[model samples]
Target: MTSATLHGYLEQSARRSPGTCAAVEASSGRQITYGEIDRLSSRVGDHLRRIGVRPADRVGICLPKSIASLAVLFGILKVGAAYVPVDSLAPPARNAFIFNDCGVRAIFVEASRAENLRYELARLAAEPRLLPLDWSDASSPLATYLARVEPEGGLTVEDESARPGPDSLAYVLYTSGSTGQPKGVMLTHRNGSSYVDWCSEILAPDESDRFSSHAPFHFDLSILDIFVPLKHGATVFLIGEELGKNPTRMASVIAERRLTIWYSTPSVLTLLVEHGSLDARDDHALRFILFAGEVFPVKHLRRLKAVVPRARYLNLYGPTETNVCTYYEIPQTIAEDRSAPFPIGRACSHVKARVIDANGRDVPRGQEGQLAISGAPVMLGYWNMPERTSAAFHVNSSGRWYRTGDVVIEDGDGVYTFRGRRDRMVKRRGYRIELGEIETALYRHPAISEVAAIARSEEAGVSIKVFYASRDGHALSLIDLKRFCAHNLPAYMAPDWFSHQQLLPKTSTDKIDYQHLMRME
Candidate 1:
């Protein structure tokens, strides 16, 4: 039978092709078939139920990306529970905050990481059951844990009444909040399935297709990487944390596995192109190179297209609240002199988008305004934070629309070009300026690899500070950078100060850590 929930996708695929390879460990070349994953997840679901986890309960997943983690994710959904994945690399104190905030019933974690998490949770007086994913230590042996928890003969029949529907909660993704705490964004099965359906219609993956899982489990991008491939009985190569950081190893895996579709942030794709030695590798199987999370420099994109001219490049744009609302397919040929960033194309077929002014009125074409999205892909709301959730959307006669907080100008043809974040625009010397615009101009310089522009307020006035990393660890002359900025940007928009680093700091999800830079003295 066809199913609407995320885990049901795996079930359907398993029934259709039981023996087909479902997932592969990129590091070890170990593979798991669809039937195997389905059965393992069922046993996991039985264990969760036996341990008193009820439908609609919240469960935490704190293990790194691996085949076992994927099974646990499906298992949570199988029992009609939403999984909350925390960054395994993050400190236990931070992970404890999320567990306490969400009030998770239980957490699936590796034994090595569980000690720290257990201590932090105890310190917070939050006692959630911790189920170890692996039993490496002598104290927690796999044999003993399995004998106690493993189901007899493995559960094959699912409790249909306990299965979640389209509107049931699927997962909660926590994002950095303005109040210096992480806020949980609640998403339903419908929220995930709608986007997955839209992508399946567009990409049309068959059972033979091989997709790359590059994004971390906690990131929103993983929604597409894990679910889309499973829905079509395709293979997903799980890129572990170590393998994800090494560009050469990643490139080799892509070539060896013959990955057809790749989805990740622009930063990762840029790293592969620059340092992965793709020019000498055989990666002709790549059909689609989809990127989001941050702007892609046109110069760098042009170079990537030159390297893999056969694949289609798409720029997907959206925030964590909405999975992906708008997308633009890059033209095969980009003029070498083109410097401006590409437009975030019109809204997806599953969603409706509007450019609204500050007063919540629709802005005319060619005017700058906030982009609002309303439709299937939009999230339910922030978990238990009704006041903040209400403020995040604009309600009207038509429907509730999510205010993206991104400032964009819609062209006459309806394509939207990102100007900057509403919070990133500042007034200096009586002139309004977009710090992202300044960063975009600086990226045109061949010497710059990564860049971030931040505005600071001082007793005297607002000052713009630019931080950048030069290509190949080469030192960039401040005078040369200032001269280039003056030529490309307006005098008022020019950065007042410039600083260089061998490499810019990145967040856990691999995006440039602008907040960290802002905190720098």
Candidate 2:
């Protein structure tokens, strides 16, 4: 049977291979099979229905990455309610904003974090029913909570009238807004399933494949990590927050568990290559390594290729508004001294990409312009912000297209290389400067582990400031660093200030926190 909704993937997998492992916890060595996932999630859905969570209602999930969380997610979908996942590590106020913004009727959270979240929601005059996954009492555990809900007969029926359709809202992902608060990007079942179908076709993993779920559930990267495996009856290993930050532990998990397909940001992969000690371990089981969210420095990618030569490397590109619209597969061999970052590649099979100038006209190949995406994977719109949503897209005779807000150049070969963000370009002393270009050049240096270039407004003009972390904890001489930058970059593009730290602050998704860097003295 063809599954119309995202949860239907799990139902299909369970029916085909009920005993096959669906998910495994790296820290606890716990595993859950497809049959169990189906049954458990059905119970969750039944409970939601009992609690008056009707179709199209929003349900909040504020727990850590675990089998239970995955079950809760599917259960919410099973009952035709959209799930709103907040970063468990984020402050209660931020989570409260998301809950209130989406108007979630109930929240499933861990006991330890529930009180603060409840308090914050109350202060906002928003009261969502709180269901703790684990109780504080000595006798109650997660199982105890599940025991309270009676399981339905089985997975929800395939009748279109009884469940959500492909166009129904599946989840609401909150991303950093230009304003102080975060805004929700609403994605429907069709939006998710289209990307999942494309990936399943491209990767073609069988039941034996093991996928690494490294990204947090709230992040868009987790969409592929969690669903692609489920669609093909493969196992997904959940990497916890603490373990995700530890390079050594991450390396061990990959090699020990034999994770077949690994997906994460280049920053995390860079850490693994620099400190994971990959050369010493036998990681022959890995078949595909995928990265997205940020550009992968060519130099660092070269090092990773040397260690895991057998695996196919792919660079997936997109924002939360368009989930993985384009991808570039690294060639078998790159020049040993390649310094330029690789292109984000062509659009995905299900998506169409266009480069348009400021005047809304299509730019010629080799000309820089803003990238626009229109396809199955394109999001429905921003939640409840019609004006913002209207401004985000450009409607014409062809169709409505979401403006990616990313600048790129299309080559003769039909590949799109990321230039920089539209807003990241700064005019300094009559010359336009791209901060990402400076950061790209600095990444070529062997001593620099991670770097970010910021544009600052000073009395004289807009000056560029560079913040970097060295491979070794010790700081490098400013003279030498400046000399290196001078040799690689034009005089007008050189930075005015440099700051060195043992490590740059990272956001919950593991990307460098530029906002935090800007706030630092």
Candidate 3:
């Protein structure tokens, strides 16, 4: 009777609307209905089970966005196995580390990326079975491979009684670790289903809604884009890699396809507003514009709002360890207030968040302290790192809490606003400076298109350096930036060195590559 797992919702929706379209490829004009998804995923699931994929086993998926990829994702879950999404665009060494760390039973990859996988797999001690799914250039089709593993008509439903419980692992998302390697965050069926259930209640997507899947599967934000739509029998319109990189084209696709739900990082939305010609689109049916991953610059957000005119904006905040613990509805009243960053808002219906001081005690309203969260959305903990997991969580009178490294301020109204990372706070010139505050101020400037702030050690002491991308091809000199900073920021906060780059480097997840930027200067 209970539908607390992600696959449970998928099966429920499929039974409710079998003929409804579940996914569409924008570039190819191809669409797959829920009935088709149920069948194909069943087929894939049979294939996986025949190849020794059992309940609680770990599988890795490193394919691009497509109907095949979605089928594999559900198929892994259908067999009660947890999947690890490997970033196809990441370096081979990084992928190898994830493979060795998780000890995945098998990897579902595309033939196009076979060479890359082979290179990474060579370095690993444990050899996982490679199930390549690309048959574009092959003489045969995927059915040929399926027949090898599964017997005729073996795609029938598995034993429903064997379905994983809420506590069973559903997926493992790897995030950039402080030690430079990636750490896998283990999430159970209950953890992911809790987030999906919360989203279903708040931002419900009916069959009429066409959700845009902009973020890659490797990114946690893509969870809402993928699962939320599938649960409601809505269509998921995949934005290709080329279009995701070009915001202007992405806007055109949104208008052309009449995508109803838009979810992506604030940086991607900012790019769309500045260069995506969103205002020129005539048929942009976007009703909900959900942004997260990083803070949105107010200036860029205002411009985007003008273009959509009627869309509702929601700021979603959470780390990979906790998926969307807090959300803030952007009220029109705050459009005029630009002095402080937007609030991360209150916790979701199923999440509990509190601001705690350094001593692990709760802080009074309006005081800056570390943000902590507990509840259904929290992860099971870091994979295979008990010491690190123990250090990350703290038990108090209320409940066990996962300590978020982020520092936030909670107003008397219970709204939480992000300050900066606790580690990012540095002392320079006998004054404490937050690098994020500097980056936020620099974003307000007209000339700087994108910026990243870092603290560098110098002979005199520590100095601030900013690597910025210019909007006008380096028209603004370092003196011009210095003068602007002098007017807007404190003496210690202003960067002593300004490095100009054509574009800010980005990680595979599309976040600013601050680590790489720090090495530039």
Per-residue CA lDDT of model 3 for 84-125, tens digit only, reads: 998877776788789779989998877777777777778776
* Model 2, total clashes: 0
lDDT of 3: 0.84
Superposing all C-alpha atoms, what RMSD in Å does each candidate have to the true structure?
Answer: 2.3, 2.4, 2.2
What TM-score does candidate 2 reach? 0.96
- Which stretches of model 2 miss by more than 4 angstroms? 135-141, 149-162
User: lDDT of each structure?
Assistant: 0.88, 0.90, 0.84
| Candidate 3: 10-residue stretch with minimal lDDT | 137-146
Ranking of predictions according to lDDT: 2, 1, 3
Model 1 C-alpha lDDT per residue in residues 1-521, reported as the tens digit of each score: 23589999999999999999999989867679999899888877878887778789999999878788898899999999999999998999999999989999999988889999999999989999999866464332323455567654443455678778999999999998857789999999999998888888778898888999999889999998999999999999999888998988988888888999998888888888888977687556999999999999887898889888899988999898999899999998998788889999978889999999877899999989999999998999999899999999999998999999999999987788998889999999899998888988999988899889999999889999999988878778888988998899989898888888888888888888888899987
CA error at residue 358 for candidate 1, angstroms:
1.8
